[model samples]
Target: MDLKKLEEFILEVGAENIPLGMLTITNNSAAGQPVSMDNIRQTAEIYHSFGIPFFLDACRFSENAWFIKIRDPKYANTPVKDIVLEMCSYADGCTMSAKKDAIVNIGGFIAFRDPELKQKIAQNLIVHEGFLTYGGLSGRDLEAIAVGMHEAVDEDYLNYREAHTRYLGQVLTEAGLPVYMPTGGHAVYVDGGKALPHIPHSQFPAVALGNALYLAGGVRTVEIGSLMFEHVDPQTGEPVYAPLELLRFAIPRRVYTRSHLDYIGESAAICMKEAQAIRGLRVKWAPPVLRHFMAQLEEV
Candidate 1:
């Protein structure tokens, strides 16, 4: 989603000319969803054509691994550990967000076998972050990350989470609410555009939905819109354009039970049923970057 970060990484890798062979992408998948080995192979081949090494953002490898094993029984005998390692081997390096599949408190890691690249990245990591030895992550957090990574691969855990997501999706869809197709992750996405087609991007649909959900059931969700990109002009001090607003309901793994998810679904249904358009908020310019969060709202 954050293409900026990916572009930066690509630039860094390309600068070294490390023969970056392949880049793996998901096929409309979500967190903890399975991906096919054939998909991976095809992606690798695409990159191989360019004679560059390939790397996958294996944050959801656990789900993909399971999917592959189930879909292709021929690989049933192959251990997930081996499959993941082999996939990683196709790339010179890979990075994963520990907070997702790993389910750690909050952390991330990049792995590579190349001694030179590893050393260089490690040096930069030390200066930018903390020492690789410390990396600002406590030992307890590291242990949790390790354990969570293992737990993420458990069939029961993945199944339960997937079922819960599907249940929520079904509830919202049956209620005639706009919902994205259920994928592997624990979250359910309510399409703000569908929910409020009349409301323009500048009106911030996600923020409106979030506020409505709170008023209805005290539930909180985030907007994945371009609100973060909106900026006021320096001289005239006016917004260039309104940003897209999307509400994201993130479900933490093993936290909320089925009943809780049902409650969320119910709340979403209620909010959508009673949804109203948000009137654009007028902005009064201030020096420097405006803290939208601190801006006072009045029903204009």
Candidate 2:
């Protein structure tokens, strides 16, 4: 995280104008990079200095804790659950998609350090979601989350998870794919811009690379690039694109084995070998917002 850039943006925008500040622990869009505990603390200090409430997009909190334990020597011996608590200590609240780290099939929740805020949010939740009693989830689902959240922080499970993801990154790199190094917690992101230099960001090279991977071996991936982050500058009326073109392979928990990961890495390598033949894409139709989710495209 660039502390200078964040502080600059907050200052430029005026802190009073900002409603709240949020930090995604495993910087999801940036190759799922893990944020260190020190960075988290410093960020919280900045937000609080501006009288802004800090929140966490903590769906993958456990995974991030594991990274902190392994990467930061200071926390090398700390328990995963303890690391998770310390990470959350800096935030005023957190929003979690229980489906991720909690390992539940469905259900999500927002937590707040202030009871007044919780009560206020609950009112909105009651109107849009189900009653505050269940929060739109079944008893079974809630129970699952209760059990799974504890399991999510199990050190043994996290160790295996890291190893599993690292293996895929290694395989992809060895097979000549440009993978993000020091592989992140939950996903292996390929540098699509480097892998498919023949295709340009204007034409959505990451999307094309994603499509190629699917065609090669049914290895589905998501494009985190111009297709998702591009926008027209209201002032200049020119396109502003994401800095990196990434193809993310999010490894699901306990869903696939190492062998399955091998297949995915092999598939990406296959796509890379014939990357020159891969065509760029142009949007055929798209929604005004979140075009990546529902957009249709044609090869350019």
Candidate 3:
């Protein structure tokens, strides 16, 4: 969050009304850009001054630490684990999806302070998740999460993980498509609004490109665009769209090797060349909220 804008909002809305502040490292919605160490510390200070609890949605914490090590000069030589600790030190608590940073197949965990709060969370967990002991996970799953959590911060793993994501971005960029710069931690985002300029954003160009990528080579991708982030005017039934229309190729950790990325690059290159042939999509059916997940769209 931008400190200036935050202060303005706080002043307008009154600080007492604010309950919490949350930050997502390698922000998923921002094409995976890392939240800088400077930004993190300053935001913590601002939130603390306002008596607001600060938290992290640390899904990609490991990848974020890796980005900090390479991108920021002050932490250029800092170890990944130490960086992770320091980053966490600035937050009151965090939520983790093991599927992302920990590389686990399933399950997630929460980190927090305040003993009374912990008890409250445990009580809530029992109501929905299960016994707090293992949250209903098998012993093998628990073991994998424990080991994967540590391995996620390993130096070798961090290097390869970042490199793989960057390589895909480089390849796609070379193919003459617009890719988000400084390649983020987990995926390469193609600016589909630019890639398929002939198809207007109103018609869901990003979704069309994602569908094209899949049909071209059986490669799956997700659209981050108007369809996903748009808001609706309830009274008027007017649709409001997001600013950027992106299509992401999120690479799974330790899954595909060099050849796989090369194949994706070639497929994307073909998609770019044949972009004019692709058609935008219109929502055939949608739910009242969060429509992108299950909405049915047909070619326009």
Candidate 4:
């Protein structure tokens, strides 16, 4: 979150209307960029001063921690786990999905600093989900999450993981592919707008590039730009647009080696060469909300 903008907004709104503030580490919607530790601390301070609790969407906490360790000079020698704890200390609680950093197959959990809030959460859990203990999951699943959390913070594993992602970005960039720079910990984002300038935003260029990647080499990717971020206004009927158009290739945890990424990069280069031939898409049918997730589209 932008602290300055938040402060101004809070002052304008008198802060009472806001219940809490949420921040995500390694924000997924924006090319998996990590939030700076100093920024997080300052945001926490701002929220606390306003009497608003700060929470974290920390699905990729380990990856974010590793990024901080290498990127930030202040945390150069700090252990990844220690850095992670310090980050968490600023926020009152966090919601986590074990599928990401934890490497668990399925399941998610929440942590809270307030015992009173935990008790309330337990009661709600029983009503909507299952018991507070397992929440419809078996003991084995919980064990996997516990162990995976520990493995996720291992310095060696994090080093290799981040390096692998950076390597893919470097290779694709060297091949003249328009990928986002300073490679994110999770994925390589291709700048679809620059790559497919012939296809305008209204025609969903990023979505077209994603489709082209799939058709070219059977490599599936998601567009994180206007196609995914923007939508048709139900009331005004105007098409809202996002600032940037991106095609993302999310690298699954411990799933592929450099050879696999090498093939992907080569495939992307080939696709870029044939990009002009790719046709843009127009939404044929879409729901009222989250249209990008399941919208039907056809060649424009």
**TM-score for each of the candidates:** 0.73, 0.97, 0.95, 0.95
The clash number for model 1 is 8
Please identify model 1 stretches exceeding 4 Å from their true place. 1-36, 51-53, 67-83, 226-246, 277-300
Residue-by-residue lDDT tens digits, candidate 1, 91-205: 6677777887898769878877678988888899888988886577888888888898888778777667667777877876776667766444546666776687766666656
Least accurate stretch of 10 residues (summed lDDT) in model 3?
Answer: 109-118
**What lDDT score is found at residue 143 in candidate 2?**
91
**lDDT by residue for model 3 over 1-300, one digit each (tens)?**
789998788788988999888999978889989998889999889888888889999999999999899989999889999999999999989999999999999988888866787898999999998999788788898899999999999999899888899899988888887999978889999899999999888899889998988988888999999999988789999988878998888999999998998898888888888888999889999998889999999998
In model 4, state the lDDT of residue 32. 86
2 or 3, which is superior by TM-score?
A: 2
Q: Which residue runs of candidate 4 sit more than 4 Å off their true CA positions?
A: 231-238
Error of 3 at 133 (Å): 1.6
The collision pairs in model 2 are none
C-alpha lDDT of candidate 4 relative to the true structure: 0.89
Candidate 3 vs candidate 4, lDDT winner: 3
Hey, what RMSD does candidate 1 come out at?
5.8
| Top-scoring candidate (TM-score) | 2
Worst 10 residues of 4 by lDDT: 174-183
lDDT of each: 0.65, 0.91, 0.90, 0.89
Residue 190 accuracy (lDDT) in model 3: 85
**Tens digits of per-residue lDDT for model 4 on 19-66?**
888998888878888998998899999999999999999999999999
